[model samples]
Target: MTEVRSTPTQRVAPEEPPPSDPVAAAWTDYLAAARQLDGVRRGAATAAGEQARSVQAAREELTVVRARLAAQQSRLRERGVPAMALVPSPPEVTVAARSMAAGPAAVLTALRTARECADAADGVLDARGWVAVVGVWRASRPEGWPDRLRNLLVYGPLAVLGPVLQVVLVLTGSGARIALAVLLGLVLPAVAFAVGWVGVGRFFRPGPDGRLDRTPRFGVLVCGVPAALCTAGILVAVLTG
Candidate 1:
């Protein structure tokens, strides 16, 4: 009976000190850093995009100015005034010194003095006037169908072959036609360049500062892209034929 006696034991409940954990604080800090990094990355990307757009905008502005200058020159030609007169003059002032020693009104002397003043004033006026004229001229020139088509016709092929002719010959062994293709290639782009220079001169106007008022990238693209496409077409036709 004594050997059958057993000892009774009490159980103590386990304690949890607090709900807030250090791990959670670390996680919060990590998330904050991640968010800040993301914000900085986004800001940089935005700035880069804006800068690209600004550059494109500036290019466009120059083209517009060129067009305006051309138009103004054309208009002046109609009025018998040289287009150059519309151009701004350098800002050098001319001084005419007069002496009272010439004596009492001296009708001949007065007439001479008057003429000199008039000539000086006219020169100043012409310089300023031309600047305005050129500005207007550039603004009004047209960039229409003919100009676009011409550029496409010329630059298209050259743009394509200018960079790829050698590659094609090495791969295809079409050496016989290579010279011909190259010739064709060079011609089209040369024509396009000439067209562009002339067309730009024809349409765009200048500003008061004698600068083109608008950018011509669109015009350039219009000509350039088409020429490229034309080249591709020609190449494809020749290859497949």
Candidate 2:
């Protein structure tokens, strides 16, 4: 007993508690599954929304492309192109189908490309139309007619109309009618000037560059001068005769 050594006391780590009740464990599993299902639903909804937007955009693009193509086809037909020549070839149809095979996004891209091509074609056609119109204008007018002279051709007629009517009234009618003609002389020239300004901008304004047809000063003079002269001449004739 005296030779026996004292042994040191060893500490034991405590064991973890046993698994929770089966019902509680099952409830926890159910909650995890429900959360995962909810997440999946949200993801699917997001994808669907994106798909719907893409589809709508593609449909709009298709409509625009179809309208442009139809217009171009009509224009080609008007320009003496055979209907058969305007139809897409089998290879072209196949190529177009292949381009849109990737899905709605691809279809949208193809439609946008087609729209740009249609716009370029429109520009070329418009340029050609302008050239034809300019050629006709040159042929109709005297060569070397300045912008002012060309514009005057349009403005001059409108300007003279009021004065001519006033002169006619003066020659045919007396006192009250003459007074009416005189009053109209003041009003009509301003009206004529406004009409000519609009007409010049609408019909005769040059090209895609958007230059003004002629100076407003020139138009004002062309429109106003005739009326003023006719009014003066009418007064002189009335006083003398």
lDDT leader: 2
- The segments of candidate 1 whose C-alpha lies over 4 angstroms from its true place after superposition are 1-20, 77-85, 88-241
| lDDT of candidates 1 onward, in order | 0.56, 0.86
lDDT (tens digit, per residue) of candidate 1 on 1-241: 4677677998998997778888999999999999999999999999788666655654555455556556555755765987668665554211212332333333234444545654565576578789878877755444323444434443444445443653454356566665555465546555555565565555544444675422345445544564466556667766887
Superposed on all Cα atoms, model 2 deviates from the true structure by an RMSD in Å of 12.1
Give the deviation of candidate 1 from the true structure as CA RMSD.
34.8
The positional error of residue 13 in candidate 2, measured at the CA in angstroms, is 5.7
Listed in order, each prediction's TM-score against the native is 0.26, 0.53
